[model samples]
Target: MKLLRVGPPGAERPVVLDGTRYLDISGVVSDIGEEFWRTDGVERVQAALAAGTLPEVDVTGLRIGPPIARPGVVLCIGMNYATHAAETGAEPPEHPVMFYKAPNTVVGPNDDVLLPRGSAKADWEVELAVVIGRRARYLESPADALSYIGGYCISNDVSERAFQLETSGGQWSKGKSCETFNPLGPWLVTADEIPDPQALGLRSSVNGEARQDSSTADMVFSVAHLIWQLSQVTVLEPGDVVNTGTPEGVAVSGRFPYLRPGDVMELQIEGLSTQRQRLQSAEQEA
Candidate 1:
């Protein structure tokens, strides 16, 4: 099932995508959020669809919000793709390199991506985001990790090179947690629909020109392994999001010019969905 949320920013209601039409599931469940996942929301929605009781919602001009509600935590893995690591002059790590992006940074897929004032090195990173459905702790193996996932979706891990590399003194969250830095979802394809998470193709383009075009197959750490590895140290709770790193071809590599106001980014992961966001300057902070 492809789950989604549609409406104004704070008014989004849950729905399920059936081909081109969207069926209102708000009557069956609240927003696709932590509580929804904890109560077997997917199974309830599936049952509603099977019983043919859901009504079609006309979302002709409403905004499409992120599929899941605000996550408790937005975790990110960096340099998981060997080629991406090589492009940035780093060697592949022995284990997943993890970081965090503020949960507030998440915006709707088609929303404008805001660039901080005077920013000169903003960049785009197309990644496959994993959404957690169940609590994941130490009692696990890589083989059991798949059961903890709820869905998969597209994520553009937008970054600011200067803040991330130059002024960060080594921490990555500053550049990564900027407002609207994470544009997620057009739809969250349920786990059952994706039997093999490692086989999807991920690609991104800037202003219609190709940037990162790669596949999950190139990732040094597979989805299940990353989850299992992370569980050993931290608990992955329901509705937490994990961005499984981006592929090669970002401005940080010096091959492409860094993003500026007005530049647009388009990203896609096969079978999950696509996201398109335009870069814009943010108003000065109060």
Candidate 2:
């Protein structure tokens, strides 16, 4: 099932896409938040759809917000893609290299990403994001990791190289948490709908020029393995957002110029959804 949150920024309402139509599910569940997902929101939405009593919403002026509202933890995996690591002059990690993005960075897919103060190296990372459906702590093996996931979404792991490399003393979160840094979702495609998340093709473009175009198969550590590895150390709860990492074509590779005000970034993943963000001055958000 494809689930989405539509409306203006903070007032987004939950809706489900049935073919090309968006049905309002807010009557059944308040919003697609932690409580909704943790309490079987998927099943409830399914039942509501089966009953054929949902209201059809005219999504004409409604903005598509991040699919899962108020995600608990925005966990990210770095160097998950071998080529991406090579492009940034880093070796493949022996294990998943993790980082945290402040949850407030979550914004609508089409929202304008604000350029941080004195930032000149704003970059784009088109990543496949995994949304947790159940709490997982210390799983048995990688084989059993998919069971804890609810679905998948598209996440643009926007960053500023200066804050990430030249400043923070090796902590990556500083560069990763600017306003609208993480543009997530057009929808949260349920796990069942995406039988194999690793085989999808992902691409990103800056101002209509293609940049990163790669498949998830190139990942050094698969989704299941990352989940299993993460579960070994921390408890991943329902509604947690996990950005799996991007491909090689980022600005840091020196192949393209960094993002500037008015630059448009578009991200696409096969079968999942797409996201586009316009670069704006930081004060616009202030």
Task: Find the number of clashing residue pairs for candidate 2.
Answer: 0
Per-residue CA lDDT of model 2 for 1-286, tens digit only, reads 9999998888989999999888999999998877887789999999999999999999998788999897888999999999999989999999899999999999989989999899989999999999999999999999999999999999999999999999978999999988789999999999999889899999999999999999999999999999999999899999999999999999999999999999999999999878899998997678
The lDDT values for all models are 0.93, 0.93
TM-scores of all predicted structures: 0.98, 0.98
lDDT of 1 by residue, 17-95 (tens): 9888799999999889899899999999999999999999999998999999999999999999999999999999998
The segments of candidate 2 whose C-alpha lies over 4 angstroms from its true place after superposition are none
Task: Name the lDDT value of residue 36 in candidate 1.
Answer: 89
What's the TM for model 2?
0.98
